[model samples]
Target chain A: MIAKQTNQKAWFMVLPVFLVVAFSAVIPLMTVVNYSVQDTFGNNVFTWVGMDWFKDLIHSERFHAAFLKQLMFSGIILLIEVPLGIMIALAMPKKGWGVPVCLISMALPLLIPWNVVGTIWQIFGRVDIGLLGHSLASLGFDYNYTQDPIAAWITLIIMDVWHWTSLVVLLCYAGLCSIPEAYYQAAKIDGASRWSVFRYIQLPKMQRVLLIAILLRFMDSFMIYTEPFVITGGGPGNSTTFMSIDLVKLAIGQFDLGPAAAMSLVYFLVILLLCWVFYTVMSNIGEESSNGGK
Target chain B: MNFNWMAWTAPTASFFGIIFCLLVIMTIWELKCPGGGPRIGILRFETTRGDRLFVSLLGSAFIHIFWLALFPGLSLYWALVFSCIYALAVFRWV
Candidate 1:
């Protein structure tokens, strides 16, 4: 299937995509970079500020707490969603009309708008009229998301799980479906148990898609803002104020553009670094598993 | 018969209810024409009907989220317009 000569003209096909990305992503990122190194006041007055904002942000207790909270939230969601999604995908019906039914149902939560998801939980957690809050109260539990920090955190976590586990499920299901039928048939001929089949065949095959799912979930959860914003509005205290929320509060709420811009660059870098680590580690594990199987 | 309709009228309920309806419609459509055959699209990968559905739904969700985030005070109808166009393109090409 190798072509005799390499054709360079195919690169032209990708030009439009590159242009769109540059305009939509690169330009605005440059603007943020510009703001991160400069101070501005009324009448568009600007002053060079160097790395002062970044230095301050590094030392700020508020930034540290928010960063830690963001880490905890992302860690918790990944822990819950990845395993839960795999279980759900494993339990799904493999044949007949049930496959589409299951996929559609699972995908439903993911299609809803994020702010709408936030707003939904906001109302759904009202102690007076919301279903979850009311049911919890009737069951003799003290549940007030607006007043209690623990309850607010729990609500946020639950809301995130409900909204996002479907994504992981869908990705895992796709991975499962891509596995060849001959693998299962070979396992059957070898009298392999279900667990062994999954481990030796399905799990290895799913590693790539699983990595993708983890990367996406990590990035999205780390940058989560609108959902929490609409739900607890950063909570009874700053309990749920993740880095993104804190940046928004600094930029818009307090009009500290320079610091906010610097914080955002740091946030973006953190996500990029974590994703690289995840990709490298997961790919190494994938190689090791494949080598061991061989 | 004194059930509180207000309880069922919440936006969350409506959003979920709409999703359920979409699922039902998709199920019925699948029943009418069972579709698992793979076709190559713009992505140049073999994909089936379910894959397209997942991509379109996921893409539209991001489009709506980005739309709302970028233009806070604007009506979501504009996002809906973009999402619809995106769905059409996905179905037609990918």
Candidate 2:
């Protein structure tokens, strides 16, 4: 697949993307790094703090708890959404009128704003007015997200699943759609079982898209803020608070800029590391499979 | 049996209702025009009409959500405006 000519002109085409990333990502990231190493006390006063913020953050119980909670949230979501999305994509109508119908319906949940998603679920899960809350209450379950940590976690998880599972479904559907008809025909000719067809044909073809889906979902969920902020406000006693929420409370709420900035860098590094690991592992598996097929 | 028309007035319910209506319209449109050849867009990937619609809808949702979150006291009319623009751009270019 290597190009016959090594052309440098391609860099010109990439300049816009590079510029946008520089301004939007790199500048703010540098500002965070600056803030992470300095102490500020109003009136434009500051003091150099070195790695003190990072040191304190590393030993902080709150940070550890939030980190663990964040991990758990992402873990649970990937577990539920990936398989669930694939199954839904599998069941989706493949042709004619059903294609658009299935796509539009599946895409509907994803279109709502994050906060609006929170608002919708907030109202939807209220004991007095929310349909879910009312039904659960009528069903004789003690489900109060406002007062119970377990209930709050469940609500947040369900809200996220409702909000994001569509992304996975859409990615998987695109992957499924891209699969050639010849594969199906060949499987039919060979008398392959349904599971075997999925395993050998569909799964292999979907590997690339699934990798993208997992990475996107992982990063988004790890940095999730607004929806949970709107729905539970990181409460029932900080039960649903993840790292981003904690960072915001530290930086904005208490104005602990140094520690918050340090935490942010750490958070960014963790995500980068994990995504790199995922990419390496998945691509290795892909290469191995292709080699084996040869 | 009497239907609950009042239930349809809620924002969430109305959102779902609008989605249902859109699905019906899209279904009819698909039935009328049965095929959509893939077109390459800005992403340099070939996408059919359904893929374009998915991207547009998803983009619109994010636009609206960000609007709501960033500007709490303001009305959603601006968000709607931005969303429409986004949808148009996505359909045309992506």
Candidate 1 residue-wise lDDT, A202-234, digit = tens:
889889889999999999999999999999999
User: By lDDT, who's the top model here?
Assistant: 1
- Judged by DockQ cut-offs, is candidate 1 incorrect, acceptable, medium or high? incorrect
Write down the TM-score of every candidate.
0.73, 0.73
lDDT digits (tens) for residues B1-22 of candidate 2: 5423111123434555676687
lDDT of 2 by residue, A84-186 (tens): 9999999998999999998899899988989899999999989999999999999999999999999889999999999899999999999999999999999
Candidate 2 residue A123 C-alpha distance from true site, Å = 0.5
Q: After superposition, how far is residue A46 of candidate 1 from its true place, in Å?
A: 1.2
Q: What DockQ does candidate 2 score?
A: 0.01
